[model samples]
Target: MTTDAGQYDDQGEVPLAGYAALASVLATGVGAYALVARSRGVRLPERLPPWDVVLLGVATYKTSRLLTRDKVTSFVRAPFTRRTGHGEANEVLDEPRGTGVRRAVGDLLCCPFCTSAWAATALMCSYTASPRLTRMVCGGLGAVTVADWLQYAWTWTQRTAGQ
Candidate 1:
């Protein structure tokens, strides 16, 4: 049952339909990948190497942060979200706007943890289609991730030394 606004209930407004649509899109994407891989005679790897897995994990983390939090990428999320404030490390804080699908998308776009699933899926698909290119891309992202950590460490060290 919905509230008078037709968007809320006892548990408040939950975008069930919107979430389902997003899930459907994800499923469709995976299914398409499988079909394309099979049709192109691509062989699935028996198992991913531990190093490759680590690379993908770092890449996914960085990619997710880039898409969801970076100030430069806010334009992509602006349509579905409203800027509320600035966040740490050159990130923007945004609140999901609108209702239903739009809000669902905004929620996904604003959350690094949520977006990481999509990033990992895309990276895995790329790896399946072209391991060499995927590895290069993952390597670059992984490098950036390390560099970011180092930058933070440097700042922290300076602050500590000053104190």
Candidate 2:
């Protein structure tokens, strides 16, 4: 059987092994959650309420953006990413660096869309473990998300008024 690394070796610089490793970690986390829940006799909710879904969605968006782009969090990504430039709203633009796992992690850390899945998974797990706490945390992030949009809207209004 051809390994992912060897198979993708001739296909250019794709980090198949690194991607596999990341996938493994995600799978392990999910599997562990399932096992622990089962062992503890914890029941899965049939479905999340629409309001909860909306709150979680906003929280995921903000959390992913903070992790992937916020300047304040650059230290977390600095080891794996190189600062490319500045982004709007106190965010930084970064490009993945290094090879294999390092580059893969950098890619994940630099792309909000890519990080959203991880963030959502973590948030969902937290919600499952503690609904009240998760809702509080999500509500705070959701509020921040709304405040960010309001800030942008206010800036736009001021710009238009000045014009």
Candidate 3:
């Protein structure tokens, strides 16, 4: 059986790193949701506005920045992860492999895609618990997201035009 570059199942031991991290994140999200629901006596709304979707998208981008940006990640792991290299937007740090849970969490935090799910859940839960504030925050993020995309589009156009 042909295996992918990162796949290790052919070696008789499958890597549990991703699954473990996902499960940990999911479990934590559920617990947080429960806490919020209990404290606020809130339930998921039957429907959300179209604007809310945009808000969620923006929140995801902002959350990804917070999680994966070098400066932010460095601050998060200052006491644990050691500097290993330099990343585009932040200093890259070595995972705390010797410290089991911290290493796993650091891996998750260092990955924007991995952190998106957590951010989404938090934003969604907050929407139910505090719709007004959530929307305000989301609105700010959504506006930025739109502006960023427009900037990228303009830059691409200028580059392609050979100006």
Candidate 4:
């Protein structure tokens, strides 16, 4: 286990300081956006179509990184072969409540945002890696972008319809 923190462990290497900085910048941007939205009276809601997912995803992903870094990552017994941890070994694992809706929104935001960022870098290797991999990533991104568009369209339609 190697840590950018200058150590090695069985858990492998911790992410570089670059990931930490990137996460921090993302967190700040999301927080600032939320604050600005609130100031404008654009009340951010917590639900299926919540724009808040951007912030939550950033924070949650960051938290996951921190938790994993601490080497306190927990594991549970698997079913089929009595194996533990994630993957097909634990097919019956339950997603925490709110995770679905939250991740739905995350999928609707995070992927697209990330896709753009990685594509912009050109070195992220996610965009032009392989046709199949690129398609999967872009497809996932399109899902979120489409959902976001549809959400805005629906809201606009409702407002115009006096809803």
Candidate 5:
């Protein structure tokens, strides 16, 4: 959504809001997708490049997390593993120092790390008020999130970095 000036807020004057919105929506999508993919054990088409996964995860995660809100943040924080003993809610997005988000986003080399990083970034980016972004976030808050993440998982296996 652009401002009264007909300028896309995020395109320049206020990019953070847009970015945050993107992040929030993607977070919901990724979280829901991760949960569903884990349950269905969906398979990817092929192996993606080593860095491709990371790049994709980073790009997607950062894009998703451009927003921030308790509900949205909480939704984005959905845990990959069902093992509750692993950590707390607030801790889900918190990864090793420079390992998950930055590292995952940078090397663009690992799938698991990149996936987790993307989730974290989404949760981190959520912090604003954009109906478009919020609506997008809500849209993915349900099964749609699951579907999107599953798509991402499939995307992961389609990389070609190994060859």
Candidate 6:
């Protein structure tokens, strides 16, 4: 339903799925906070890299792709989605099971944009808790992120060059 702000809002009885998503986000935040606290206690490096935000953004992008998409999630989305096809791109099947916590988690898992937030939180907290390992992982993912963009750009160039 549309709210007074002219934005989308839930109508009728609020779905538990929405509640589940909200709770999950809050819980994640609390967990991140705890990690930060522990990092401080352990005298870990709290300062971020020079381009840490940008790095995390790239890492989140790669992580989202790993979580969502077809072939990637096919191996992991069981009990939530039916696994079908022969590991092809469009083989992963999503089975919507009405409104509930499971549905909420399924939705979150199916959308990279949604999952990116969770990934970013985890990466950010990890950076504080263990900068060395976090940087290694994020750096590698960031490299892949750049490679992905370059591949897209290359394809676009090839197509446009023909014109």
lDDT of 5: 0.41
Per-model root-mean-square deviation over C-alphas: 2.7, 3.4, 4.9, 18.2, 20.9, 5.1
List pairs with backbone clashes in candidate 3: 70-90
Model 2: lDDT of residue 104: 89
Cα error, candidate 4, residue 25 (Å): 14
lDDT of 2 by residue, 1-163 (tens): 4557546555567777888899899999999998998898778788899999999999999999999989899999999999999978788899999889998899899899999999999999888888899999999999899999999999999999999
How do these models rank on lDDT, best leading? 1, 2, 3, 6, 5, 4
Clashes of each: 0, 0, 1, 3, 32, 0
The digit string of per-residue lDDT tens for model 4 on 1-163 reads: 3455545445543333434555576568666756765676654223322332343344344333322222223231111112123432112222211233333323223233443442333312222233346445445555654565687798789889995
Candidate 1 residue lDDT tens string, 1-163: 4457654567656777888899899999999999989999988888899999999999999999999889999999999999999987788888888888998999899889999999999999999989999999999999999999998999899999999
Number of the candidate with higher lDDT, 3 or 6: 3
In model 6, the Cα lDDT at residue 15 comes to 48
- Give the distance in Å from residue 70's predicted Cα in candidate 5 to where it truly belongs: 37
Q: Between 1 and 6, whose lDDT is larger?
A: 1
Candidate 3 lDDT, 40-118, residue by residue in tens: 7787778998878877877887777666655755777655456676654233544433344566566667667877888
lDDT of 5 by residue, 76-136 (tens): 3333111122222222233221322433222222223344555544432331213245335
| TM-scores for all predictions | 0.92, 0.92, 0.66, 0.28, 0.22, 0.69
Q: Stretches of candidate 6 above 4 Å error?
A: 1-14, 21-29, 32-40, 43-46, 82-96
What C-alpha lDDT do the candidate models reach, one value each? Answer: 0.91, 0.91, 0.71, 0.39, 0.41, 0.70
TM for candidate 5 is 0.22
Task: Please identify which of the two predictions, 1 or 4, would achieve the higher TM-score against the true structure.
Answer: 1
Say what the RMSD of model 4 is: 18.2
After TM-score superposition, the amount by which residue 72's alpha carbon in candidate 4 deviates from its true location, in angstroms, is 22
